[model samples]
Target chain A: MLLESTEQVSRWHERRAAFAELDPSMRAEALQRQANSIRRDIVRMISAAGQGHIGGDFSVTDVLTVLFNVVLDVDPHEPRRDGRDIFILSKGHCAAALYATLASAGFFSPNELATFMKPLSDLNGHPANTKVPGVETSTGPLGHGLPVAVGAALGSRIKGAPARVVVVTGDGEMQEGSNWEALMSASHLGLDNLTLFIDRNRLQQGARTEETNALDPLDEKLAAFGLEVRVIDGHDFRQLEAAFGPSTTGKPVAIVANTIKGKGVSFIEDRVEWHHKVPSTEQVEMALEELAQ
Target chain B: MSTLLDTAPVDNRVAFAEELIELASHDDRIVAVCNDSVGSSNLVAFRERFPDRLVNVGIAEQNMVGVGAGLAAVGLIPFVCAAGPFLTGRALEQIKADVAYSQQNVILCGMSPGMAYGELGPTHHSVEDFSWLRALPGLDIVVPADAAQTRIALRQAVAEPRPTYIRIGRHKVPPVSPETNVLERGRFALAREGSDATIIAAGTEVSKALEAAEILAGRGVSVRVLNAVYIAPLDQQAIAAAARDTRAIVTAEEANVAGGLGAAVAAVVAELPKSQRVPMRILGLRDFAPTGSTDFLLDHFGLNAAGLVRAVEEVLNGD
Candidate 1:
């Protein structure tokens, strides 16, 4: 049987402690308001840039919000702290959500969000670890993040540290053969400290993932590769927070977060053409209005 | 001719393995990663001593390289050992992406490189290792001439914090470098100095080039022989000096003539002032070697001492 640490038990206890400091009915309201603010920030940033992967940005917003707000053991002020949990965005095209989430968590100043993708800006189209304080590795190529995450997780394990490694990859990007190789090795090494979260938005560059090359039965595939599988609603903050709980088994965990492309926005949600389509001025106003409520 | 020599003939692979073991003993973080070829790579001793540190990925070259990158990511200095053909040919993309582009500090050990597996056919021969690897940036390619140079090169690679490829030959070679010679990157060794012509060679060709120099000296044709251990960052100073002083230059290696030592030397010589430039001849594998013994294959490919002398004479005559 896996034993839960005293520190972890106390952290679980602090969840209630934080709630006790708030009014009984205000706790849920506070979290909902914070989530809505993060979504609004994501919409505003992507709309101003006029060029971003708004689909994945919206789909993964709540997941990132929950991780930054509640789940992860990270110190935004000290991003390079040795004991901090590493969060790697393998689906790097979703820079808007990551930038907003990072800024909201104070990894960098919130004012820097205005410079995303400008000429000579440190915030390029994709997140670069050399430029961003909280980014762990530079990733845009598919199938690169899991291997690197495996390395960081293995490093934490070798050093006997309690830090966990979380990597988020796209559903379509799993077609690269290197991901399976990493999966097998991570499972064989029994890296229980590692967690892979698949952003199953179901849309790739050109077409729907099923119309391209299907990655359905993703849970079975990951389980076959020896990872303990957890299917969750990616946009649900409560589900994401629960899935981010400490692993009870001494094996790597794979959370297949089912999400819709362009989630939260009315017209673009679940639309295949919106994988990287930037919203126009009118669309941006509509999105901001929807998110403001 | 039959006088007794005190030293025994040693294969460079043994030297490579022994040096690696010594380095690992001092640094516990040094790990050996192989594609199920521990015996062929002479890593039996390493596996026996440190069983936990040896990661045998079992016949998957791609996975072997990726795992090496993973190990490097975690602060372990991994020496990925495998046959030359499989290591470079089978997993070229992995080498390019994971090791070179990712800038992972993993030592890629190509065992039995460059047609050393004679009669094993084209599939087994690694004649394209140099051409394939030289194209990739941020990787140091070192083909040691003999045991001493191999040891020095291995030690230097371990101490340096970068990606490197060490080509270890299966064929036996006579020790050329003096025991006092320290190996440094982009530094060439002048085995003998002459003014008539310069013979630039690496790997097994270095000894043959020296032998050819002795033959040319007998005929009063003074020749300069240079042993090029580091191929990528070619010693520009030494190569430039050879071009300036020598009447002509002859480059030889156990790889294709397209992008190997010959192409590298040609690139350097082409950039020099026309008046200072010398006539050149690149003697190496222009095509795949026919199935035969290693000795016959070398002779067939014009890689022996006699072939080197003729090429030097031909280049000297401007033919």
Candidate 2:
């Protein structure tokens, strides 16, 4: 089963409540600790499974951490409970990071993490909403989540629900025309309840996004699509927390989180090959040791 | 024009818009999403009734479908309406992943399907929708025969909020067996019951099949007509019965002969014992059409009543 018991759920709620009450510095320290642990989980999971997008996973770990622990109002026990803030991992190649985060949040047992990408395991290479509790929708296709986010936000407004819809997409995924289409729709509908958090790790599967598709004027492009853009150092927990605030611009907020792929480990940082490159046993041990800090 | 064509054919889109508005009035969960196709999709009345409920995504089919799936995920019943070719062709992967694979409660409204846009050319023709959509598993693909069946399909969608795709007909068609009081779920409506030969058809082609049965009767060929409503969970029971009971089986649709209703019947019949099997004729477009009006194109491709009767006679004569 995906979710833990009701007791574990209450513990999760209590932990998030406590984290929310923490001052900025202490909250960052706590989040940094959890993000590091999630990164360690990524290293161990990839090394054992021999299949994972380690670069994007590491790059997106902190965003997932901040959203689950402090931002998103989801009940791990009731993943489909109405009025809960919906979170979608559009950049779903980074399922390792999402699985680890959801596990930490008690959406599912950490034991299931051992079955990552194995035959007949629910933890496949990409997240499946039918099998996984925390996944709002089955999203692995690039440029899918944001459009759905727009619809969710619109539906919420139509029903007068106080739910917020947040989706995280890879910066390289921004090259997809559908994202621009969704951005235009969101802006046209004036959806303040929607937030698009982009994991700008500057790398896709084959090459750096700049050298490949060149999203150099990404800020202007987002602004052109009518989103109130906020560029942030994605590694900083405080900035991650700040970028997720309610949109005061009366429009959708685009959080362009500039990050380093394979972050926290010195060797893998910004290295393009680790997009799904399996880590060696020695490399995994060294990575975990560095994350132990 | 044949007396069969004399009946004032109602565009089933009228039934679509009326039923949607009727359903939305009672249940606020019903919201319509279109790709700047509000007027063409017959959603103007819906917009007028509840302006906020109509989501026009500005000429983007991919985003329109994705948004509809998202809306459904968020506990809203979204009727994602778009032109058939664009809805099924452009955002096909979204339809596959977001709606079919995810199994969201999204109702896809493929408006004016099956060569409804005649002069506008093959690019606008949704003749390939059936072949394209039937390949997806677990999607409730329904092609309403006429106005009443159209309403029935809509109500059924709301009752069972499964991943459904309803091909809303823009081609005018007379009601099928107005006397057959109730339509069964996933079962073909046997429009005319005869023992010699059977003609199974869907959408605008159903009425043509019925008329073909009439013409066949005049020609001393006792033909049965089966109105295929549900395409995906094809009434295999009724279909196999037709194959068993009749001398021959001929499948017709306003779609390509590939993966649509005919191919569906062929697959089912291919499972039967060789002795029980009947010779079949799959009638529809084999290739893309040259420029013409809806009637000219359908007739040119032998999608009319005469075509249906000829196919039945050929199968009966083993030609």
- Per-candidate TM-score, chain A: 0.89, 0.97
Model 1 RMSD in Å is 5.7
| Fnat by candidate, in order | 0.12, 0.75
Indicate which candidate wins on lDDT.
Answer: 2
Interface RMSD of structure candidate 2 (Å): 0.7
- Inter-residue clash pairs, candidate 2: none
The clash numbers for all candidates, in the given order, read 0, 0
Please provide, for model 2 over B129-245, each residue's C-alpha lDDT reduced to its tens digit, 9 standing for 90 to 100. 888888898788888888888898888788778899999999889877562356666788878889999899999998898889889889898888888888877899987898899
DockQ of each: 0.26, 0.82
After the best TM-score superposition of candidate 1, give how far the Cα of residue B42 lies from its true spot, in angstroms: 2.7
The Cα error of candidate 1 at residue A221, in Å, is: 1.7
In model 1, what are the clashing residue pairs, if there are any? none
